[model samples]
Target: EPEVTQTPSHQVTQMGQEVILRCVPISNHLYFYWYRQILGQKVEFLVSFYNNEISEKSEIFDDQFSVERPDGSNFTLKIRSTKLEDSAMYFCASTKTGNIGYTFGSGTRLTVV
Candidate 1:
């Protein structure tokens, strides 16, 4: 019955600007993740966090991207500089364990102009 929550459902930013997307996963979950889907493309994993550290990250999570649980409650993704290619729907997800299903947030639509 628990759920993940994402804020600012949509965001528009200028290219080269910075943006931070926020999410609060199910309180008791142990693993949290950030994924993104470029319009009409498959969803891609960006990073996975556990125990306050990054457990896994995809190639897409380059030097410009970072994730942190600044308050041990809200998980955030920061893009150092926005790019037109970065426009996509970002999703936050969490699960009690890897074998279990994940609860995903509605998604944050980021648009770079």
Candidate 2:
């Protein structure tokens, strides 16, 4: 079985600072996504990428947020300016198809102070 991998399992940053979360999806997968969950809240989708372009994005993915596949295998999320509200567990996921099954990375816990 394949899985998504995220780095720096945890991160602490000052408010207004920039942060980049990294992930590597299953090599064979075609769809990739970034999702976040504020502590005690439901998971929220941030953005979806396919074929080197954004396929969909949530309102949460505003001007401050961006996603990139700098290399064919590494998918990354950049937060231009962090906010206390942005402190959460960010997950990376991928699937061969947009079906119900998706492999999600353990998550990167970002804490904005």
TM-score of each: 0.97, 0.97
- The parts of candidate 2 lying over 4 Å away from their true place are none
Q: What C-alpha lDDT does candidate 2 achieve relative to the native structure? A: 0.96
* lDDT per residue (tens digit) for residues 18-107 in model 2: 999999999989899999999999999999999999999999999999999998999999999999999999999999887568999999
Q: What is candidate 1's TM-score against the reference?
A: 0.97
Positional deviation of 21 in candidate 2, in angstroms?
0.2
After superposition, the stretches of candidate 1 with alpha carbons farther than 4 Å from their true spots are none
Clashing pairs in 1: none
In order of listing, the candidates' clash counts read 0, 0
Tens-place lDDT per residue, model 1, 1-113, is 77799998999999999999999999999899999999999999999999999999999999999999999899999999999999999999999996378999999999999
